[model samples]
Target chain A: MTLVMAGAISHAPGITGREKMAPEDKKTRYYDACYRFRDHLWDQKPDALVLVSAEHFGNFFMDKMPTFCIGLADDYQGPIETEEFLNIPKTTIPGAPELARRIADVAMQEVDLGYSQEWSFDHGFMVPLAFLTPKWDLPIIPLNINCQVPPLAPLQRCHALGKALRKAIDAQPERIALIGCGGISHWPATPDSGKINEEWDRAFLEDFVANKTDRLLRYSNDEIYRDAGPGGQEVRTFITVAGAVEGHGGELWCYEAIPIFAVGCTVVNMDVAA
Target chain B: MSVYYLDKLMYQLNRDPMVQARYKEDREALLEEYRLTDEERQAVLDEDIGKLYSLGNQPQLLMHFAALVGYAWMDYIEAMRVGAEKYGEPQYQR
Candidate 1:
């Protein structure tokens, strides 16, 4: 009952100030859509926000990468060095450690999933939050999915993890808003880097808005990788949010293939049943 | 050998500003801490990104490495393409 709202947004660093250097029209389209998404999220007015995002070798490295991690600190610091690319003011966001602990406990106990308690957050969590809660007032529970490394959790597992998160949230007394921050398409470092798979991006968004959650989850990692590039693996974060809001449909708030960012930016507001 | 060591080196370079500064200051000494092979070290030193890609380095980390080595965005893409051609397709593409 505590899960009041759920949503997803693209967290391309370009969506930060980096997009301004792009073509004026592209910049306007991306910023306008982001503003609309931000306004809609602000209207939710939830007590806590649960953010699911990917780590870009920020917190963990190849030496010690966890498949998933949750922030358990009382307050979380935003990315410091990313200012050159993201240009967001460095600040700390409040953390819901108690709720985070509950979710971690549930994940560990029921699902046999081990998670790390780490506080560092990168652009994935900050970019959307910079827009959604610029003042950094809302208590946040950050959940990280391993999108950058190989042996990633399957989309099916991500959905199940979402369900487990919902169970954890249901146990909390505070009103919660879940935000999945990631992507639709675009490669970051490969030969195909900077290319947006418009066809795949539109199809994914269409399926999401039409409530084809199953279809969305059906795409294997290889399929997604081959079609949308390795960065597209981040969409598993969106799938996790969808799992948390099970049976609830979604409305596409905004979507654009911003070439400057090399990402198909998208935002969706989930319709949770009252 | 796994390409993981390359990723580890890149991660160290990306997360630690001091290491990055050191990389710019004394590339050889900083790289010594990492167990990179001679070819890997040479590729990094020469900024022969294509050679690094051929050596099984992950593109995600390579992208950051490219940025650190002063590659412009467009040039980074070109580097990856040229590397892919020279090094055969990346592991992911293969």
Candidate 2:
């Protein structure tokens, strides 16, 4: 078996934390899209889900941040925000250390990756997991890109990491699914929170689903900040996914800017099979 | 302002329950442990979400700390807005 499924989705904490605040129809549609994404993932019957996230200082700190990191543990705990804040209970999620180590060993051949034996899931990871694997039954391999801080990894490097990951996962015998979790264009957790640039989001998603590496890598940090806000930097996660599934275009499962969620809530199913 | 130390305090407060408990039980003592300036220390002591935001604190860290200090989602956003108005723009973006 090889890579069976690949995609990306929004992981705004407000999506879950402020669920009741959003309009009913909008929330329902967005959530339904997420549920469908989950079902589509399970249909692939993957042995592990490599959840790529832009961690918000839950485990990584400014003191020592890794540009890209993967968890190498038997189990991990999450929702570091608080059951009250994220509206998701703290719980343990299983990890596939064996598969993760193999992937890491193979991935390092092409890209530099920091690894940890211990990690606690922030909303970046928890928010998506809440919808994608509600039962917490699927084993996960958490991967993080430093989207919170600047002097960040270059977009090209993120794409390279994705290519390496694709190579590594393909070498493994187990079926694996990969999902990048991030906001498209919003100012999260800032005074400007709830502001979304739908135009910018759609443009990015267009390049993303098209697997147009050059276009996706074209965005400068300054331009991104000016148009999409800091949260838009998380596109690295999506870019990596696009790199992993190169030459394959994707279908837009959903895209909607939910203000309370502080992001253009999005879900894209990459054409891995194609 | 030492964004590093400010971030360190916030990182601990966000992830470590023991640190959160210590801050809750005896904040002044805990505040003294971090090499924070008077302004930073005071901001934490006051639970000033807006000032912290203006002081260049990371929004994610501030958001969690706001919750620890009893900020509802909207209140936290509003605090950042009000703080920006009072203290001027934040040194950092996001």
On lDDT, the leading prediction is 2
Pick the DockQ winner.
2
Please provide TM-scores, in order, for all candidate models, with all chains considered together: 0.92, 0.97
Worst 10 residues of 1 chain A by lDDT: A109-118
Per-candidate count of clashing residue pairs (backbone under 3 Å): 0, 0
Report lDDT (CA) for all predictions. Answer: 0.79, 0.91
- Write candidate 2's Cα lDDT for B1-94 as tens digits: 3877988999998777899899889999998888888898899889999999999988888888898788887899899999999999887743
DockQ of each model against the real complex? 0.55, 0.66
Model 1: residues >4 Å from true position, as ranges?
A107-109
Which numbered prediction scores highest in TM-score against the true structure?
2
Give stretches of model 2 more than 4 Å off. none
